[model samples]
Every structure is written in C-alpha cells, then in structure tokens.
Target chain A: MIRSITQKKTEEELDQLLTGIARIFIIGCGTCVTMTHTGGTPEVTEIKEKLLKKGKLVTGDLVLPVACDNLTAEVLHENRSKIDLADGLLILTCAFGVQTIARQVKKTTIPGLDTLFIGKETGLGQFDEICTQCGSCILGETGGVCPVTSCHKGLVNGPCGGTKNGKCEIDEKKDCAWTLIYNRLKDLNRLDLMKRYQKPKNFQREPRPGKYWLTPT
Target chain B: MVSLFKKALESKKFVVTSEVAPPKGTNLEKIKHHIELLKNKVDGINITDHQSSVMRYPSLGGALLVKEMGGEPILQMTCRDRNRLALQADLLFAYSRGISNVLCLTGDSILMGDHKEAKGVFDMDSSQLVATIRKLEKGKDLGGNDLDGAVSFCAGAIVTPEANPLEPQLIKFEKKVEAGAEFIQTQAIYDLDLFKHFMEYAEQFPVKVLAGVILLTSAQMARFMNKNVAGVNVPQNLIDELSTAPKGRAIEKGIEIAGRMIKKIRKQKLCTGVHIMAIGREELVPEIMSAAELG
Candidate 1:
C-alpha cells in the first residue's frame, strides 16, 4: 500500500508521442492508482490540462478500476465511441494496465507513466523503492527491513565499511540497510539473530520471466 | 445564545469537532444515526465536498441534513470542479439556507476520482476562493460587478502543517488570513511535536486554528494511509502500537490513541479546537471525546 509516485514522462516525451495526432484520449486507473494518488483521476486531469496548454487537441479522459483486470475491457467497450473518436490513447497506469489497454483497443497506445517496482513509504511524501520483484520476499527474517531490496549496494550479510554514522554510502540521508536491520534487531533485544548468515539471494526466479501461483492448481 | 463554537473560542477552551461524509447513495439512515450520536458530543460537523474527488451526495445537502438534525454544520467547498459563477451561486444558496460556516479548499485533483472524463474548472485556487468570499461580503463579484445583496460567513481554510519546504504553506497561511479567513483547520496531524513546531510560527498570526485528528483503525491501515494518502504521516512507533493489538480490538486501540492525542492537545491548548476525521467510523467519535473528557 505504499503509494509511491510513479515516474511520469516529461512534456517533451509526451509531445513526441502526440506529435501528429489530431485528438488524444487519456485513461487513468482508479483502483490502485487513485488510492495511491499516482495514476488516478487527478494525475490524468493534470496531464490533460498540461496537454491542452501545449495546444494538443485532447478529446477527453477516463478512469477505470483495475485497468489490467478484465473489467477494463468492459469499460473500453462502454467508452468505445470516445476511445474511437480519438486518434491515440494515452494510458496513465502501471505497465500491466498500459498493456491491457493496448490489447483491448485498436488505436495507438502510449504509456504516460513509467512503471516502477513496489516501494515502501519512509516518510511523508517520501518513498524508498525496494523489492525489485526479485521474485522472492524475505520479510519474515531481518525484522522487515529488506537488505536485498532496500540497500542501494544490496549488501545481504552486513554493512560495508562505507557506512558512516548509520547513513548509506550512496546517499547521505538514507540509512544503511544493514545498519537499520542491526538497530531494529537490537531494539527487539535480539542482536544475536544476525549470527544466522543468510546466503546470497538466488536470481533464478527473479528479474526474469516466470510463472507464479497463489495456490496449487 | 451564541454558537457553542463561538463561545468555546471566545473562552479559549479547547473545543472538539468532527466530520461526516455523506453517503454516496440516497440512503440517509446511517448518516442520521451518526449525527444523533455526535450531536451533543461535538461542537460542529464538517460536511466534506466530494472528498478526494469522489462524487457523493453534495456537501450542501449534507449540511442541510445537519441543520435539520440540530447540529451546526461547517460546509466545505472546493474550487476544483466549480467556476466562480457556480461557486458564488452555491455560496448565496448556502447562506440563504442558514449555513453560515464554510471551509474553502483547492480540492483534490479530479483525475483522482472515478470520473476521469470529468472536466476540471479550476477558475480559482483556495486563496482566490477566500478572496471571492470576501468580495461577496463586500457586495461585489470577482470582476467588480456589484451584487444585489451582501452575504456573511464564518469563513475558514485548510493548512497542511506537515508540508515540506514549509515556507510556501506559511505564505499561503498568511495569504488566507489576509483574504479574511477567520479560522484554519489543519490536515490530519499525527506528530504533535511537529505540530508544536508549526504552532511556534502560527502563534504570531491572528486567526483561530483547529488541529485535525484522524482516527487510526489498524497498524496496517495506518501504514497504508501513510504510504498512500498525501499530507498524512503516521509515525512508525504509532504503527507498531497499532499492530500489537489483538485481533478485533484494533478499533478500541485506535480510539485510545486518539483519546490520548486529544487529551494532550487539549491540555497544551495547542489550537482553538480539534476537528476529528474518523474516515467512515463516525460512531467512535463520541468515545474519543468522552475518553478525553470533552463532554
């Protein structure tokens, strides 16, 4: 539920996508994006306003719940006239949502936001991009702070000597992943837990195309 | 007798208020039940205007319901969807209906709502809306057009006390007061220490301020909102406390935490009042108030 702001395409990039299109329709996803305040209706409206300010012939915009789910096809079917009236579709959703719209519509499709992996909020309006979808989650151990995902250097066993005053070598304000893990374990009075060295993470199922299962089917 | 809110502010006693989100559909039974539960417990009820850009029953309609139910209603208005003409007309209509208190907001982005195809008419931001309200009070429209009759309101606006680069928010705070805002309601404040720091600067101003208190349902819920909701920050320690509660008892724990915060806020007199946003859990408002000994 960490509602990280998705990286958006610059106006120059958007201008290139809509270069010659006479009319463009923007679509936003409501379920996840709206709740996160990232790709929801507000971002779509802001995008539409920005495009209008750029003199683009933007036709209109629409937001659908679970744009990657089957419901999007139904929404597309319902709003087909508006979608068909436009020369191209600008989608403000995750990568899955963009692909879903592409599969459902015949018009040219473009992604307004670059999909990033799930992140956790560290503070207000601040997020730490963790879990590169390494295909595995090891939150049970390590007291919830992911050394593999959160550490910029990805140190699994211990903090590198580069860590100074608990801050990461890569970024000054960011806490070293190992340092945070150490402090958290210490607070729980379980500092000895670090003696159980975890092996280097396996990449077989991560950063690669693979199938996942909720239950054996 | 004068309004309880006016009296409380005049006496410098910490007052308590709460918000009621109108149901999306026409069903008013639940809303009415909530109003009855909170009528004597709180000083006023804020009727949110399509909060988070989601379309629901109008705030004006909810305010009317509050009026009929014998509760003072603070009508919230956002400028995102309405033009000045519509806004002014709505203000006039609200005044005629005996809705005197108002909280002006710039509004959430329309793109955040279910209706993405809806057009946004940001003819004015919150500051301009406050200015517009002032102009109407002066018997003039925004364009110097004279009005047939002047309208009066107990005008207020919102301030995000936790906004980073606090200068801009502070500047806007001063601008709102300059535009004739009589009161200010802050965004949901979790860290009172941070709020104290904000008040250090705010105490110099001449307006009554209200601290917004949002009820936390669960640790996971708090974490979710901290991650997702803008301008809301739930400290990790508070989340941990929420997580430690046994199943089905988290709501009670939340009420306890809110009660504690309210007690501290009242004891310190950090602000003129407290505006509680329980999200959809309006029933627990009285519990928090009673726990804080407000009644």
Candidate 2:
C-alpha cells in the first residue's frame, strides 16, 4: 500500500500552536490534495475556529486550485494585504503546495499537513495509499498490482516465506504480495510467465526528484 | 383537486416510511433483502433518485424492482439533473405504470459529487415540481400544455428543521404545502429539544409531517457529519457516548440511540411518522423498530 502522511493533529494541537500568534492567515489547496481531505476550505475553517478559541486573530483564509501551480501566486498577490498582515501563515495543502506558497510569500509560513504518496478511495470515507510513484509504471508484467507500490517492504520477487496463509508477515490481515501475484496470474491463465527470470528495473527511467517536464505546445 | 396524500392524512393513526438506495452496480441481492425486511415494517419504501448527485441504478428501475417484490414504492424525483420535459415524461410514465407516491427534491449540488464537470439542469426546484405534479393531476403540463391523460400522486416535500436561519425553511415549507404537497419529510434530527421546538411551530400547519430518523453508524460518524454535513448537529454528548463504546460495539450504540429517539417521538406523538435512513446499513431497520418496540 502507498504510505501517505496521515495528519492526525487534533484541535488541541492547533490551539497550542497558535497560542502566541496574534494574527494568523490560512491557505488551502483546491485540487487532488483538498479532495483527499488533507486540506480544504472546510478544514481551514476548522483550524480558524480553533485559533479563535485560543485568542488568536484569524485575518483571512482562501482556497486556491493547484496551489503548486503559478496561478497560486496570482491568488496570493490578490490577497496580499491579508497575507502581509498575518504574523504567521498556516498552509493547509500538500507539501509541494506549502513549499510553492512559502517561496512566494514574504511572511513566515508553516505546513499544516505532511504530504503522503498517491492513494485511491477504497470506499466512501475510506482511502488506501497504494502508490509511492517509484518513478515507474510496471503494470505490464505485474497484472495491474504493483508489488513495489503495494508491498510494505517493497519486495519485488516471491514472498519471503514469512507469509502465513496468504497474509503478509508485517500485518496479519494484509494479503501477501506473492500470493496476490500468484492468484492474479493464475486467474489470467499466465502462471507459466512467472517462471521466467525478469531483468532488474532501470532506476533512470523513473521520475527522480528535481526532474521537470513540460508538455510540447 | 388536492392530492390523495392530503386525504390519507385525515386518519388519526400514524404512517411509516423508509428509504432504499439502489446499489451502484447490478447487485440485486442487497436491495431485495432490504425490501423484504422493510416490507411489513413501513407503509412505503422511497427509492432515491441518484442521491448526493452520484449516479447509480435508476430510481425507476429500483421502484419497479420493489413493485415486482410486492412492496409499495414512493419514487423519489430530484430536479437537479432532469429538465422539465424529462421530469414530466418520467412522471407520466410512472403514473401509467401504477407507481403512486412522489417525493420532490431540489437535489444536492453537482459540485459535491464525483462528476464535477456534469452540468446541472435545475429546470425546476422542489416547490415548482410540487406545483407541476398538481398541474398534472389537472390534466395539464407545466407550460399550461394539455396532456392526453391525467395523473395523480401522494406528493411530498422535504424540510430541514435544524436550519440556523429557520425562517427560510419555514417559508419554503409553507410554499410546498401551498403548491399541493400533502406530506413533508424533514432532514435528520438528532437533537430532540430542537426538533420539539421546530414541531411546536410546525404543528400549526395542516400538512402531515414525518420526522426523519437517520441511523447512526458511530459517534465519530455523527461527529464527522456534524462537522461536515450542513444543517446537522449531532450534539457533543451524543458524540462522546458513541465514541466511548467498546470496540466493535458502535453500531449497537447507534441503534440504541436511534431507538431512544424513536420511542420518545412516538410516546410524545410529535409527528405523523418517522422516515428511517439507515444509509447503507438497511438490515438494521427491523432491529431499530424492535428496539423502539414499534412492532
């Protein structure tokens, strides 16, 4: 499963953080991060209420779509006076969004959430992080289930023999990665393909940190 | 002519109703189980029309499934997605197929659902939809156009008693009653004190009111709704009670809480009936009624 940083800070933690700060400004993201419930207008409002209870003056709050995008700078520019008046900035966005806003703002900025990896909604109100984005998409040979993405220890080959009755060694309830692979391949009638020796994954082909790409016009 | 639902309200005995959300896919076993469980317990089963703007198996199909299963279905119609023409056509088709009850709603905003890019066709709000139903009963269309055959329904509308600005909801409630709405179902009410206060003011009106009883899953679920869901306040004490339950016993706790509310409402005879919304946990309806000692 993908490991995303789950922000479990309670209202009490927020109150303690904003105790001395007289003026606070809140910034929220509107894209994938916000939809995932890490940061949004609603979450920002909740933080604002906590700060108010702690006697901190919440100057203003705004949600920008794709806070990491250049458009966020324009939104901040439009609300510059509010941003400038604040003693501290609380950014309720992904880590990237927080960094982008911090780079643009002249005031002191802090992140309200630690960014986790990409996840998928398993059910209503239930999210399971399933991808670390390891700079590769290896669904072609793996039957759509990424062993590198899902396994807790990121084991690429067969199970380490620690698995008991298809459950992972790390967690009893979680499925064993090799077991899932066997089942998926068996269902697809491609069990013979698992016997072949596969080449080691090329690290250079994956998306590395500091790498940037722009679409051709 | 006034709706038949208004005529049914003349009876002194209270009525019972429940809602059933059709599965997203073609799974019929769960839906069938719910229908069977609620068959004798409720006077009608309201099949919701794409609740929360999320697409699912069609409401008409679900209603038909209920009809086939020998259950009376109150087909819920929302004006958010369908235009007037489609609305009128569907109503006519429903009436032709012998479906009776119709609950009109303005529906949830399109921005809240998975399909954000989908355009909302709010051709008519709930009030206008009620008025249109009345017009159909008179053998006429919304555009003052004539129809080949007349149609009738036990038309109903929804009200939120816990609205902070109570006057606007009251105004809309009155307008719906005026627009030939014979019955009204309210939004989920967890705070009885507030509900009693709302009833004190609402009782003056002539229409029959059914208090909505939404089954709580957990105290955290209740708290989450209170924090996120608009116009719903589950109260802090209730939240604490739900949160403090022994692990895996939260559902039982929720049922107990719902039963307590139902018993109080029934003992007080506050409203005409209760509309139980168990959400996905419809199997607990019998348990809830049994807990309240209703049946």
Candidate 3:
C-alpha cells in the first residue's frame, strides 16, 4: 500500500507555530501516521500531557481511524462540545489528513508532522519513495524502476558521473537508481533502452497544482 | 565560426585548459589574476559555476571578466539553480556577450553545499542541457518558438572516467555526444591505467575528450577524496608517495606527481587534451604546466 511518510516537526518549530494558541484540541490518525508512529493515539496523549505542563489548556483529544476519510466530519461532530472549547486543532497526521480535517472544521488547523513523500513500505519499517507522478511516465522503457523519484537529480538519459559501485553520491547506503534500472533492463534483455536518448522533459503535461476529474459536468 | 577552443581541439594538438573559480563576493581581483596568468599559457580558461553547490560569484560573470581580460573563456553552466526558461535565457545572454564556449554539468547535490535548505532546480540533466544548447543553435527556443538570433556554442559535457561500474557513465557519455557535446572535460583522474581503458572505449565517440587533472595538495586530501568523493579513486601508491614527501613540502611533491601524470597522458596520446583543475590553487597551474614540459 502507498503510505504517507512523515517526520515530526522540530520542538522549536512546533513552539513557534503554536505560539498564539493557548487552548487546543489534538487530533491524530490511526491509519498511516499510526503505522509510522508519528501521529497516533499515544502521540496525541503525550502532546496533551506536554501542553498541559506548558500551562496551556488541552480541551480534548481523539485518534480518528482514518483522518483523511469522508467519515472524519461525523467523528469530529461526535465531540463537538470538547472541540468547540479550543482555539485551534493540533493535527498530528499527514498533510492529506490535516487538510481533510481543516476543511471539515472551523478551527485553525496546525500540522505537527511534515509529510516527506508518498512512499511504499519496502521493508519492516523502511519506506522508499516510488513515484513522483511525472505525468509522462518512462517506466515502460526503464524496466518498471522509476528514476524520477529514485535518482537524486532525477536524470532521465542515464546515471550522472556520481555513481560509484552501484551507490549514489549523496549517500553511500542509498542504491543508485540508474544502476538498478540498468541491472533490471539487462536481466530482461532490454539493454538497448539504456542507450536511448531521452529528450528534455515536458513539464506541461503535469503542471504544478495538478488536478484531474473523472467525469466533468 | 568555431570557438578557439574548438579550433584547438580540431588542430589535433595537445591542448591545455585550466579553470578559475569566481570568488564568493564581488571582489574579482583573484580570478582576474588567474585569468591573466593563464590567458597566454593555456588554450582556454574555464570559469566554474558555484562548484560543489556552494553559492558564489556567477560563472557567467566570471566568463565575461575573462573575455574582458583578452582570454578565451569556457563558461560552465550547471542545472542546479535555474529552470529551463532561466537556463535558456542565460544562454541567450551568454551568446550575445560572445561567451561561445560552455561546459554543461549535472551539479553537485544542494545538500552537499553550504545552503542545505535551498531548493535544487534540476529542471534538466546535463545531457538534456546539451541537447537544449543544440536546439537553441537552430533558432528555436525550448517552447519551439522562432528566434531572431540563434546562438551557437562549442558546448561540452563531463564524464567520470574512473567511475565504478563504468558502463553507466559511458552510456551517459555517449548520450552527451548524441546530444551535440563537441568536447568532454572528464572528472579528475589519478589512475592512468584506468583512464587508458576509459579512453579505449571513449575513442569510438566523435567528441573530443580532455583528461581532468586536479592538483593534489596533500596525501590527506587524496585519501579524503578516495573515501568521500564519489568516483575518485587515488591509488595507494600515490598516497604513499605523497606521504614520503618531507614535512611541509607535500604540495611540491604533489605538483611533481600531477606533472608526471599529465606528461604520461600526453606522451601516450591518451586523449586529445588536458584540463588542469587547481581547485583554489590557480597560481600553481603555470608550475604544473611547466612541470609537465608544456611550458
């Protein structure tokens, strides 16, 4: 399953973000954030305790099963009185969940975690970014390995001169994406694809602020 | 008209080029001195563009300075700070100013630089940047719009000759050639045997290859590059020789070693030319040239 990988904001940044808010209702997610240990029930309870000790009023807290789902509105309505007593909603979830909750509530929503990337759980607890949704997909030629998201510079033609022993220059532990694609293509007898010249990417296909509709009125 | 650098490459002579890095601030005194010193000695002088992603004086500005000082300037452009529109606009500006030589590079990662938080705008890779240069020469913009004045450049790209798993780097080298790279200035090479092997394969390409020779200041620096810098493998013997240099004279010994390698590369006709990168030690380029018997 695609997961929203995230990391908690620094204590200094969080303090600055919540400087004006005194009374707050904490909300966490039980889905992606829960699995990532970033924003779950225990995290919400811990923040509630920390905020209480910092001389702020923690009106209430709740860990919605799926904070980004349409059912989030009804779950928040169940605890309206507790939520209404707060000046802001401290959302300990991914950007999707935080935005979902913000639209359903009138309270000022503050994100506690930074959404790093939409990734896949590659190992027990390891997540790797799989795709960047670069509308003109080249996976068909790259043997199913997406270089746009994997290569540090997102070079299309081939690997930069920074690859050494199948590792990227940025970090020795990280696998060089081109080497991976090269090996995959070599195994499938498609090494000719490695020699093909990829032209300059057309950024118009997936313009920034990407939007799409399945059925237009 | 072909650039002087291109003419030198075509002349089949043992061409020599050295680089000058722009200072961090507006004080261009140091670079000016380096340019004046190398103007008559080397075939061309290359100006670096925020090398290592550390923000510094612009390479375009430095290249103009080289031009003003009556030297052939090879402008280095990286796909690290500018988007396609900005890159194309800069190329136009560069061409209009008569800076007709360019070296396209896939710059170092922004995370490796001083400004760790700055966004890296790698809108095009080096090969794509080379292709864009070709497109601009044909009187069209990246958007396929007609241009009143088309720009022509003796555009070049870089390759890591000793890059591990050499096939991948070779592939990119070929793509750069296909994209209209007329010459290539390779990554700093310390091992000649490995470079000969790379040249054996690179000879098939139509592009001119200039072997990169970076001056080693000390044994420690060589070891650091071996351990930290990617695709740079300084043989153990070179390190031992640097270590053997009497205290404080390691730089002199380093100069000897660099001169020796350049001499061998020239004697063997390993490639078409040599690009000496005296990183921060531009004054010693003349001495390196002298040591190589090219002076």
Top candidate, metric DockQ:
3
Using all chains and alpha carbons, the TM-scores for the candidates as numbered come to: 0.59, 0.57, 0.98
Model 3: per-residue Cα lDDT over A1-217, one tens digit each: 9889989998788888899999999999999999899999888888888889888899999999999899999999999999999999999999999999989899999999999999988999898999888899999999999898999988888998778799988898899999999999989999899889988788779688998888965
Predicted structure with the largest TM-score when compared to the true one:
3
iRMS per model, in Å, is 21.5, 27.1, 0.9
RMSD of 2: 24.3
Quality of candidate 1 docking, DockQ: 0.02
Greater-DockQ candidate between 2 and 3: 3
Give lDDT tens digits, candidate 3, residues B162-230.
Answer: 888888888889989999999999999998988988998989989899999989999999999998888
Question: Which lDDT tens digits does candidate 1 get at residues B1-295?
Answer: 2345555556656777898988889999888998889877777888999987799999999999998889988899987678778999999988788888888887765666777678766556676677788889899987678889778887888887875434435655776787778889998899999999999898898888899899999998898877556557899989989988999899888999999999999898888989998998998898888777777
**Per-residue lDDT tens digits of candidate 2, residues B207-258?**
7899999888998789777755656778888888888899999999889998
Name the best candidate (by lDDT). Answer: 3
User: Cα lDDT of all candidates, in order?
Assistant: 0.78, 0.77, 0.92
Shift of residue B161 alpha carbon in model 1, Å: 1.1
Deviation in Å, model 1, residue B244 alpha carbon: 1.0
